[model samples]
Target: MTWLIFAFLNALFESLKDVFSKKGLRYCDEYLVSWALWFFADLVLLPSLFFMPIPELNARFWWALAIGGTLNSICAVLYIKAIKLSDLSITLPIVTFTPIFLFITSPLIVGEFPSAIDFVGVMAIVTGAYFLNLKQRSLGYLAPFRALMAEKGPRLMLVVAFLWSIAANFDKVGLENSSPLFWVISLFSFISVALFPLVVYKSRNFTGKLRRGWRSLALMGLAFAIAVSCQMQAVSMTLVVQAIAIKRTSVLMGVLWGALFFKEKGITERFLGASIMILGVVVMSLF
Candidate 1:
């Protein structure tokens, strides 16, 4: 399959993962869900290790994994926290900004530069996000920005977006130094280990939460593994921006999922912003 096709698959699976995470978050603590995500994903994917050869490691590769894994732990926890606090449609669309930040970060971290056209795309994405807060524009034209700041979920997701911008470059570096499958497993393992202490402190009965909600949490983990694996493979075959730009389409899918599954309101508004953002992402990645 083509690299873009893998990217589309990554989008599909990522949306599904968000939906699953939201479902599990209904009864499970965000930290438990976060920990279970890496735990079960690494667990299910462990079997594939036997078939894939371990790539030779270097100091640079280890550094990338450590830094990326640390940032990933932060994003993972905040991601679940975002979903827990707001509607999936409302929060997920903000993640499209990762590509916008990637334009700047990739140049510095990975030596990839963007053209003027890509800057326009970034503006389109910003405008799209503005549309998401039209409901609160009663105060002023700029109330959307204020509204986003007021809403903790959107705010947290935006932080996650910025962190992901940094992580994307590290991901490209990691893939360059290691195979996709190997990188996924290794990175997940490192994050899982690094996050253990935080998870323990976040939940007094973390193991009990896992035991009680194993089935739902396992499903969440499964979807996460599939999405990440597909994304890594897509990135290996193309630029990180290209893969992530396509993957941000998951925000659109999240809008639909929120409407269909959760019967969440504001679908039209979210869709307007999400569709435009996805368009901007496409323009940014391809041009």
Candidate 2:
């Protein structure tokens, strides 16, 4: 039950990180924001390594880090780009598709297959996505799905979701080979370093942008660190599925943030749709 608290906290802070990233993206390029996320998070996370005993490394750990870190670095950039290019309500809800993708990637990467009940969850996700753009249904029955495909942000986020499914399997492998804290620290550090070269290559005034947006970037990183820490702690205490289902609550929080912070329209539909999607994830994860 205590794990529930940490899981909920993970959801809250994860949403906050999205809010901050969206806000930061207003002034900063996606590259800078993406790099800043991992870099500053590492700044907050790396210090803790000194306070805890280091876990023994293994070939499996290194393999997971290499694969997951590279995939996540690309996902991070694409995620920020999605947010920058579209509304949070539109882009964030699409992330819920990750679980559906996990049904594919997990079996291939980790040799784990979901039960028959998970099919119902898949249908629910598809249905919920339809409702997300219910306002567009006047155009046609398939309009909502078409809208999702037409929107670059949602399309890119779908890619992020798919890549995340693969990375998540590696994350499990990495955590199995090392402590959660060490894995988080190592993965984040690896991503930060991986993205640094691209951030420099893509941005003309990287230092100036960082100097200007340091506060927002730092806060976003802190939120991300807290979110990941709470998630890892919760996972340590509970089933991975349970922790992840609880964490998907961030999708709902993201929709609310969209309405509140950005004053994005279609709140009633998006919120309802996100709620349904979250219920689908919970169903898949729990039963």
Candidate 3:
């Protein structure tokens, strides 16, 4: 049950991160926003290492960090690019597909398999996400699928979701070998460093971009730090798929933010879709 609390908190903070990241992306390229995500998160999280007791690291921890960090660094760029290229409501909800992919990766990587009921809940969430684009159905029954294929953002986000499913299992392994905070700190550190060269290469007027967008980037970093910390804590306490299923509720909040902040349309259908996602989360959590 405590894991549920952390999971929900993860959802809240994760949504905040998405909103802030989307705002920051207005002034910075995906490369800079992607790098700043971990960089700023490291700024917020690194300080806590001094206050917390250092945990003993193992080979497994380092291995998971390296692999997961690489995958997530790639995912971060794709994710930011997705949001930059399309509506947040459209691209963000596509992440709900992660739980579906997790059904395969979790068992193979972490030896954890979700039950039938969990599958049902995952289906509901995925279905609800599909409904986020329900307006597309006006064109045809398969219009949503067609719309997804037509949009670069949703397509890239689909890749991010699949990669995340695989990376999350590594996250569980990393958590098993180290404390949650330590694992998050290490992972962020690795990703920030890995993306440094790309950020430098792809970004022009980097200092100016940072200077102009520092507030949003800083908020994005803080939100991301809290989100991942809560997420790792929840993951440490529950099955990876279950934990991630709960976190995917962020899509609901992302949709609302899209409506409120960005004035994106289709709110009626998206809200209905988000409501179904909430029901699915409840089923997964309580049953």
Candidate 4:
């Protein structure tokens, strides 16, 4: 029960953080935003490292964090690029399909075969998501299909989803031998700190954009750090796959935010889709 609450709170914060991030991107360069976000998260993680035991550091832990951190940076870069190139509506739904990839990968990678009902839930989410993306064109409701075919956003999102699932699964493996939240966060922080010098040296225009994007980037980094910490902690305490399924509930929350705050219209189908996906989440949570 406690884990459930933690998961939900993590999801909620993540959803809000994404909203703020999208808004921040309006005036910022994607690369700069990415760098800033990572930098600040590392800053937050630095102090925690001082308190952790030196003996706790092991080759397995370092390797896991190194690999996972590298992959996650790639994930962040792809996501930022996608957001810059396409509509949020398109990118989010496609990425929200992580469960589909995870569902398939979990059994193969970790040897955890999901139940038949879980597969049904996966289908329900995909169908609902697709339906929600539907738009009315001259051909009538072929909008989503046309948009997906025309835009790189959806494709990039699919790729991001696949990478995130792989990274997430490996994260579970890595966390097994690691110390508490501090070291986990510290490792992530180290990864980010290592990247900053390169980011600045490679991109001269980054600073100009940072002037405008810093706050947004920092907020995203902080929120993301907290969300990630909560999730990593939650996974440590429970099942990583189930933790992922619950976290993906952000899709439903994103839909509501889009409808209410962004005033994005023509999304009745998305609401229905989110509702169905939410149902699957509930079932997955319960059984």
Index of the highest-lDDT prediction: 2
Root mean square deviation (Cα) for candidate 3: 2.5
Tens-place lDDT digits, model 4, residues 60-148: 77776777788787777678777667655555766656767878778887787777777777777666665655663445566756656
Q: Can you write out model 1's per-residue Cα lDDT over 223-254, one digit (the tens) per residue?
A: 88888888878988999878878888888999
The lDDT of each candidate is 0.87, 0.93, 0.87, 0.70
Task: Write one digit per residue (lDDT tens) for candidate 2, span 145-218.
Answer: 99878999999999999999999999999989998899999999999999999999998898998888888899
Is candidate 3 or 4 superior in TM-score?
Answer: 3
TM-score, cand. 1 vs. native: 0.93
Model 3: per-residue Cα lDDT over 158-235, one tens digit each: 899999999988988897898778888888899999999998999998989999998999999999989988987898
By descending TM-score, how would the candidates be arranged?
2, 1, 3, 4
Clashing pairs in 4: 132-269, 132-270
Whole-model alpha-carbon lDDT for candidate 3: 0.87
Off by over 4 Å in 3: 1-9, 229-246
Q: Which 10 consecutive residues of model 2 have the lowest summed lDDT?
A: 19-28
Q: Considering lDDT, which of the candidate structures 1 and 3 is the better prediction for this target?
A: 1
Which of the two candidates, 1 or 2, achieves a greater lDDT against the reference?
A: 2
User: TM-score for all predictions?
Assistant: 0.93, 0.98, 0.90, 0.83
